[model samples]
Target: MFDSRHIQTFAEVVRTGSYAATARDLGYTQPAISQQMKALERAAGTPLFVRAGRGLRLTDAGQVLARHATGILSTIATAHGQLKAITRLESGRVRVCAFPAANATLLPATVARVAAAHPGTRVELLEEEPPDSLRALREGRCDLALAFSTGHGGEATDADGDSDSDSEGGLIELPLLDDPLMVLLPAGHALAGSSRVELGELERERWIAGCRHCRGHFVAACAEAGFAPDIAFATDENLAVQELVAAGAGIALVPGMTLPLLRHTGLVARPLAPAVGRRVSAFVLEGHETAPVTALLLRTLSEAAADMERAASGSPRPEA
Candidate 1:
């Protein structure tokens, strides 16, 4: 078998194009570098280098081996990095999936905290809705999932009827916060000055709906109010919904987690009467919940959520 050390040395030699330079760079004696090259060539069953004037050149076999060796060494370095991260808890990669709103508002500060505290750790964010985030967590495609429930009885379920249990095979859910859905209205609309609005009041108003589950919540709420909404536009994007409301196209129901991302100036938000909302939670594989990196990230997320809550309540931000 070809030793990884020899393959690394060979790649370094190709990079430097001089045995002495490779030896200096790798902290190996010139003779040791030569010996490693010979060993690599023998393992390849062909000569890998030749004399060209006062310098050395790669033979056809050497060129082929060098190409493969570069990739092999790079993979080895990556493996080493990952192993170091796992063993030390000072560095690692955490894959996170969240809906677009949370990705915009909640994830940024949490990820920034993680990056600052553990500079070696890498956090990757993926935008996905609740069902998809949970699926990604269960399939081992993601280490963390920031998912939400519409709180309108439309939560995703398996055969067991457990909304947040391991029926999906060892998945764990950590409830983070309840993000209440608030109605968005144009600033000049009839009910814009109210602190809260009844669904019945907006029955005839043009409406902007969200995803299928969100629309389901709106429809159910409207039905409870004895009317069906005249949904004029359907979009899941928080900004788009806000813009539509700002432009007087229609009103919408937006989740509290998306509050910080609202940039439209001509819109007003009011809570629903009787309190309709969504529950945002973090999901992970059962065994990974206690992992140091995952735990740290979870704490940061909770802190960020708290900050968002304070901001939403018009409270002054706490000093750092």
Candidate 2:
């Protein structure tokens, strides 16, 4: 019988597309990963991978094995989660992945509540972007992920269209809240005094953008308003983005969750005219939803999101 570990390693190789990456992810040496691959090939009696330029690509047999391995691993994880739930959440670790904003604003309070309530159950955080976090969730590297989607068609929704829980693709998405993208401008900027600003109005202004995806979103949002942003600075740090705006370098588009964490008061945040936003949601493998620890974390996150919504509602709006 092929060892399940070998199957898991093979699956990881498939997901990561490099033996070295798989080794790093699994904490194994590259030679060890090669040995496992060789052993797996011996058991299967066929070559499972081939060199494709600088990286490895799966062969037909490898693809077939990967499909089966995913299901097998998911089943094993479900069984493990169910068994751990039998202990009534006394112990066991839940690996969570989230984006930066959620990590800063949403996850801390929720994780604190979890730790205080279940001291024996450990929670580990991995900061990743939404796409990477979802990939990690699919590959079994994380039990839960806090993710967000923007754009008109990208919003997560159910069939009935009222809720955000997407019950498709063997995953569950629990919608938390909608975080609107707001315009950030220096206090003395030309349009800073406006209650709301349209993207087209800032076409000629220098812009500060986040990472590549965020930059793309900014450009796209501008395109929707019949203009393109002249981005002058790029950084993944939201604080740095705010700093740049405050220093008169450029303006920015920031999500609402980040507003509560800003230490700078020299910038003004105005609502966008068209109201572009992202939907924040919790993602889990379908079968693990009912696991005691997972359920507990979900409840904590839901409550935390609700509290944030309430706080945002009552807080004074940002002014120029």
Candidate 3:
């Protein structure tokens, strides 16, 4: 089959007007140039040159190939340059889909870090919960996904029930943070003043649960503490949950990462005695983990998570 080497030789011959001159210009033996031209002619299924006095002249087919070769070579060169730029992290785009809580807290800081570190790079963000974001990643709709697990310690699945197992050539999950969970209590609650609250102590208090996954985690933690939570309300909205707690409707458990973004006027957040928490992670396709832009973003995400941990520790403790 015809290839770039043949096309380059043919173009050089057309430029120099003879095989001997083309060979001299390209640092090849004249016979080698002749052999390349013969192969190219065979692949083209036509004689591309004819004897004209002491020189060679192109046939119509030769002219056609000459005209198109320039464009093809230009396209190839452009592609090479762009790929090099991407490898250097000078220019590229990264699409990230994350859960709402992360979008509010971790994402902004991560995005800012990437922008400052690589001005030519760009990051696009989408807000979605775990399984859905995981689906987006598996579907190739996004380059990276930010998701969380309640320390369940198993393969996580998407909406279509596909597992993210690297052994199965699915995805790679990298842990970023151990976002601790805290108990949300009303201002006047008897246990609000405590530095930490044991799950067993809140056994009788009405609870406001979060998303389905969060509720399952909360329930499991409660079970481990030897009691069942009396879930009086259920909602995925962090602010709504805090509002309910403030109104004395019920108490709730929330991640520390989300606490800064949430209102705390009439509520108090106490560390859980048993230290229940979810693990936040970044997910990527198995082989794409080392792609330049994706890798840089992952590092920046880890840095941002560390920054969040420091901020959480240095800030005033959540009190009414």
Candidate 4:
């Protein structure tokens, strides 16, 4: 393998035609320049220089190597610059896959902050729920995935429907926040004015479910409350869920992260009695958490989650 330092010295010597001149120009001793040339020539397995009347001149092999040296040096310099840029967070790309609720709230804030902090960094956003997002992370389709899981252990399912434990599935999870699920009710409903509602309180009412995983989580919660909900509609779209609840189709349970995006005047959201919610996390393939772009995105996401928590604390109620 050719050493880049030797290539640099060899190129300088080729340009100047004198070891002393090359050494002086590069702020190295003449002996050091000679040693570098020797190492470079040995690596090439050929004589790179031959005696001339008063100075050094490139032999045929040396000339060929010299012709290619320019490109090699350029490539090395370009690689160095790019690595520096990435380490400094001055340039890079972070492909993020997040669920719809986070895409509506946390993701936008995170993207804006990343752009403002690192103008040269690019963020590519993809929307997918936990199962699909986890799959994308494992398949190397995304740098990071913003996914949610029922706080219960091993509740997060992956692409193949396997449970996502802390160390299972070659994933690194960074738990961001616990997003409480709120019950969405018609504004005219008797319990709509209440500050909080129990899961059993809505068990008799028709339910509008969410994604497959969300529906499962809701069903389990309902079972814990000693009843099975009669799901009248199922969709992953938050707006549709809000609309259905507003139109008296069925009450829905939605994450707190999504409340800001749901503003139906005919609907009201109240925190669940026992505080049912999902734990939102950022998932990356093992060893990817150290990547500069991924690390930056993760930090920004943590900050955004903190901000959301602070804002929610100040005003716990979600306006209709």
lDDT of 1 by residue, 1-320 (tens): 88998887888898988899998998989999999898888888999999888678999999888779877876677456434434433347788888888888899999998888889888988887768777666655667888776645667322123455665456677777878889999999989899899888887899999988678877887888899899999998788888888888989988877777778888888999978876788876666667888898888998988888888788988888
> Candidate 3: global Cα-lDDT?
0.82
State how far residue 87 of model 3 sits from its true place (Å).
13
Q: In terms of TM-score, how similar is model 3 to the real structure?
A: 0.66
Candidate 4 deviates by what RMSD?
A: 14.8
Best by TM-score: 2
TM-score of each: 0.68, 0.71, 0.66, 0.67
Residue-by-residue lDDT tens digits, candidate 3, 221-266: 8988999989999998988998899999999999899889766688
Candidate 1 yields a Cα-based lDDT of 0.80
lDDT, candidates in the order shown: 0.80, 0.82, 0.82, 0.82
Better of 1 and 4 by lDDT: 4
Error of 2 at 12 (Å): 14
For candidate 2, the TM-score is 0.71
Model 2: number of backbone collisions: 0
lDDT of 4 at 303: 84
Candidate 3 deviation (Cα RMSD): 15.0
Worst 10 residues of 3 by lDDT: 153-162
Better of 3 and 4 by TM-score: 4
